[model samples]
Target: MEVAAKPAIRGAASIVRALEAHGVRYVFSIPGVHTLSLYRALDDSAVIQTVLPRHEQGAGYMADGYARVSEGVGVAVTITGPGVTNILTPIAQAFADSSRVFLIATNLERPFLNRLEGNLHELTDQLAVVRPVVKWAYRAMTADELAPAIAEGFRQLWTGRPRPVYLEVPLDLLDEATALAVEPATPPPPSEPAPHLIEHAAQLLRNAKRVLVFAGGGAVSRRVAPLLKEFVEAIGAVVLTSLMGKGALPEDHPQVAGAFGYRWSPDNPVVTLMERSDLTIVIGSGLGVRTTANGTMPLPTPLIHIDIDEHEFGKRYQPDVALAADAAVTLSALLAAVHAGARPREGWTPEEIAPVKHALRTPPDERTARYVPYLEAVRAALPREAIIVNDMTMLCYEGVRFLPVYEPRSYLFPRGFGTLGSSLPTAIGAKLARPDVPVVSLNGDGGFQFTLEELGVLAHYRFPVIVVIFNDSTHTAVKVAMHRAYPGHYRDVDLVNPDYVKLAAAYGLTAVRVASPSELEVTLRHAVEANEPMVIDVPIALERYA
Candidate 1:
């Protein structure tokens, strides 16, 4: 008997297979007509879970969060035209934060491409829109090119200086049948800094009387943490992690001076450490505007900067010596050199950090005391390994100051982009990436409503992410700005919100409304133990925290 012929796999099916082969655990998407073929193909993908968020922007943010926590490529698929445009903000945010996201977007048929024929979901130059935000963008003209494009996108994620990439697949091509084989493209190994560059850094460090190690987000990887700790210990250096680099070294560690907390007046112990030091070693940070206090903080002379991105070497504050290499590798080399012999940094004792730590422990004022209860409740409800996603709000800055994150990738925020409406979806993505750990999102009333529809997704997936919405019925951050600039004239900054308990019920999520801070911990504990998506609406006055 003749064997049955194998059914032909369509291009869309191959794309799914490619993503699976690259070890993507989930694909966040908002399906439309142009993406029907891709969705149909995805239906049979048992290994790859599909998360359908309410909007394209939510999908993109979810993917970004997944990548950040998982340390893997995050995948988001969207339809042509409006879908792509809707997701642009998140893509731009990912680019700014160095998050790796792979975006697969559908486009009109090749014949209709850029013709201005007004075909459904068509753009004059869709690729042009994505190019500015992504590290790379490619358009596949034929069915066979789909898998290759995806492989290249993954390659970009695995390579140096992680960032988002976009791949456009024409609608007609996804429907076509094609035989394709895709090989996983492993990123090239981390490059080594030139021996002379390393030697120069070591020599300068050797002669320095006061040394400070400034760790950035790039130094937050697990492999780098131990080496970084070793380097700091060997040199008797004080550690000050940037906002993005929180938890890179243990905050509780005696050597660490803690993060430069908020963007306010900036008189933290970290700033004190920077001011007193004669030499600063910047590792794996771009020293961006937010991280550097917009260049207002005085950086000491004879700086040594190490970064994976060559462009960042001299961009923010030029260094006396620069080394381009993986943070872990460079830290290891530096530690070795310090052991070989360096000018001993005398009087750099842990006692010096005591006053700074005391200052960090002190609340800014009585207003900040109001948030302590909620933060205390959250800390009690979750383990140290639990992840927190903070939206644009006063609590975010407070969280940065008070929340003790013990592990890398445990705290995420829209720091670089400073966008609202990100915490909810990003929490979902973080939970999806690490299902065993508890993930909680802290969002303000105004920001939470921006992505309210994602409640449906959280309900559907049942990922057990606890969202704490600070409901004061206003855009508190904007209101604060308005109040500062133009007193008693806060127009369009306040909002009238729907009852959150009823809203949560409508989305099939468990809900509890807490009127006082005293009631939060018990309610949070109960909600977290429920093992389902839940919302805790705290009726706190927004002005109290401001």
Candidate 2:
């Protein structure tokens, strides 16, 4: 009988090798005694760069942000107990948005694992706590399992609808020596669309008189985007993007109707186009609360819906023809089936869409004029392709509805979770992922303070990112709600914040304060060209937009 020979290597070393083999370029993490071995193992690697974040939660968000823009798996590592718990918010956010991230967490040594005894960073069931939020969670009880667990995590990331995964390794196992043979991950082949369903979708789209195409976040895939553009042009259809789907087609494209649900007014161009359509074809979007205006926005009947996730097909509104497949694959097939000579559908003409486009792009009224200067400055100073991470603030709500983003993955809004403070960290991650492109985190004072610790991370990495903090001295969203409910009785919403300029200086970053649009343009132009991180503080009146 032949015995299998074991190779001699530390579990931590095996994990690093696995990550490198899988082509991971970055790992966002915090250092701890338990994770020292992992860091030491990382020292010799050239492909993977370990980024140290201020907080475990920020580390998680950095990974989340990276995954969202890069369209690949983002990885994060943390120590036991509190370290694992601190990152729950980001895990939940990834789950909600179906973002792909691999979270590597450490546990107590084998002897103390799950014993409920008083120990540092020990929880009764760490795996259980993370299981609900992640698509799958695995614990490595032995040294040899570490590499396999990582490979499995990557496999999960690539094979299904994008979601987060977790791998928990016991401290003793991480320190133990083991021989493990690991292989690089090969993504599973994309699922092909059914020919019958593809034909039906094409026929329905062709027969419809007034056709409207709805592109969701799921439609942002590289394989599907060009196909969507061609289909829209070939069919002579009007296209509307969900907030998550903003960059699926160029917003300036003549066929585009802009984003839906963000602008609550009836005059929203996308809303108007939707009303005129006799049939709608939804792609990639889940029609979630934000996209559907909390279920109040009206959608047309006789719909043809396509999605990668089968569960989302009829989740909201039943489709006349539901095709469950990847957006890129399905859209490609639909495009191939539609003959170029097919009679063009009778829908929105360029003349009809021009007024709607102009109306949506027009300047706001005097009451909300305070934000206009800053918005205009940002639009002018930043390049058209710059990435915008819109934080959850009063300004963000307006920007989400009205901001014109011209590239795919150019604008990232905290879609389902709607969490505050994710902007700065997420934007930092985006900048790291695409160093050639300019990235900006647009945040209000209240939201900026939530993840203020990340400024240190930026100073350490020295990546050029412009963080524009709107200093309104209050959580304007809450203030407005309170005023509506109890007029003149506003309390606790008024916030006192640190002088943002000084705060940025403390982090070794260039900081400037701007008041008017002209000042902002000058300050922002300088920040964009500078080769380091900078902060620009813009003071605006509280509730000015209300």
Model 1 scores a C-alpha lDDT of: 0.84
- Residue-wise C-alpha lDDT for candidate 2, range 347-383, written one tens digit per residue: 6687888887777666556645555556777878888
The best candidate in terms of lDDT: 1
TM-score of 1: 0.95
Candidate 1 segments whose C-alpha is farther than 4 A from its true place: 1-8, 264-266, 542-546
Q: On a 0 to 1 TM-score scale, where does candidate 2 land against the true structure? A: 0.96
User: What lDDT would each prediction earn against the true structure?
Assistant: 0.84, 0.83
TM-score of each: 0.95, 0.96
Per residue, candidate 1 scores C-alpha lDDT tens digits across 1-546 of 997765667989989989888888799998889989898889988888888999999999999999989888889999999999999999998998899999999998989998888688878899998999999999999888888888888878878899999999988888798877767777778778888888898898778887888888898887888888888887888887777888798888888877767563555556677777888898888887767766766777789998999888776688998888888888878877888896546625799877787677667678777776677777777778888898988778777777767788888988888889999999888888888888999999899988989999888878798988988888887888888888887789778999999999998888999887668888877776787889999887746323
